[model samples]
Target: MLTVKRLDIADARILIKGASEKANEIGVPMCIAITDESGNLIAFERMDGGKVSSAFVAQDKAFTAAAARKATHEYNAANVPGNLAFGIHTEVGGKLSTVGGGLPVVVDGDVVGGIGLSSGTPQQDMDCAQAGIDYFLQNRG
Candidate 1:
């Protein structure tokens, strides 16, 4: 049987800090969320100027990536055009947003969690998420 590991709150904190630092450097307020592999919320933060609406969206994005075990954009891209997984966003309790800023957090080639960022342009959001992922990978205990 295959086993899946879960992310602890300490790791979640690390991800949030990394993402926040990147957002601060870019002068963009952000909402960052982390979720365990099973799509449960692990941690979240919303900077002072981040849109309140982004909180839920960020959480959903993180959950979707973690549950799907793929970057949301990849899922969207591969599912288009006659693919049954197409419009999966509508089936996953409407929790999946196939946007460009959410990424799955992998460990040992297995997804263990996910990170999501919002409140900037798509590129900026992706950059902030990448920073978080890098931090997690480098600092893993």
Candidate 2:
């Protein structure tokens, strides 16, 4: 048997706020999601004026990051053209995305959750997600 830390709502809010701050700094509206290790959504936010379609994308991104335990772009880079996993986006019932906005949340060297953001360019999404992940890492034991 094993025990692992779970993200509480307060922490989820912290992540959301951190991500929102970054998005505001970049002047990008965002849809953000947080999920637990089992790929279940814990909290989510769609900022005012964010893309209407980005909510689902953000949720799937968080799910993929938590279940896959890697930054989403890492999958994209490793499974590049001519690589073995080039068409991985077609896998996992087409739910896995190798986009820039997804990141696993690690605490004490264990992936406990993930954060995802959408409604911005890939770089903007990554920047916002990274901000939330950094805050989680800094505040967790």
Candidate 3:
């Protein structure tokens, strides 16, 4: 038999709270999402004044990060013309986002889940998502 770690509600909430706080600090409304190891939605939030389009984009970013076990921006960096992973956005049922702001939630060197943020500049989104990822890594021992 094999045992595995998963993202529970408590951990999910921690991620969301951390992400939200970062977004608020930047004064940028955002859509935030967290997913389990399988890229299944664990929790989500669209901040007031956040763009509606960001809701799905945020979730997709989280899915891409969780499924790939790497930051979504890494995909963008690799998928440029003549790059190794070109046309990857067309794969994965179009769920892979080439933009920034998605990060894997790693615990003990294992990707337990992912968090993504949208509805802000790419840098802002990355910063907020990174905040959540950092908090989880710090608290989830």
Best candidate (score: TM-score): 3
lDDT of 2 by residue, 35-104 (tens): 9987789999999988878898898788889999988888878878999879887677877888889998
Clashing pairs in 2: none
lDDT of model 1 at position 25: 96
lDDT of each: 0.87, 0.87, 0.90
Angstrom error of the Cα, residue 8, model 2: value is: 1.6
Candidate 1 stretches with Cα past 4 Å from truth are 79-84
Q: Residue-wise lDDT of candidate 3 within 32-96, one digit each (tens)? A: 99999888999999999988999999999999999889898898899899988899987778898
RMSD of 1: 1.7
Instruction: Give the range where candidate 1 is weakest over 10 consecutive residues by summed lDDT.
Output: 72-81
* Candidate that beats the other on TM-score, 1 or 3, i.e. the better one: 3
Badly placed stretches (over 4 Å) of model 2 are 139-141
Q: Alpha carbon lDDT of residue 41, candidate 2? A: 93
In candidate 3, where is summed lDDT lowest over 10 consecutive residues?
132-141
Q: Residue 33 in candidate 2 has what lDDT?
A: 95
Q: Mark the regions of model 3 whose C-alpha exceeds 4 Å error after superposition.
A: none
RMSD list, candidates in order: 1.7, 1.4, 1.2
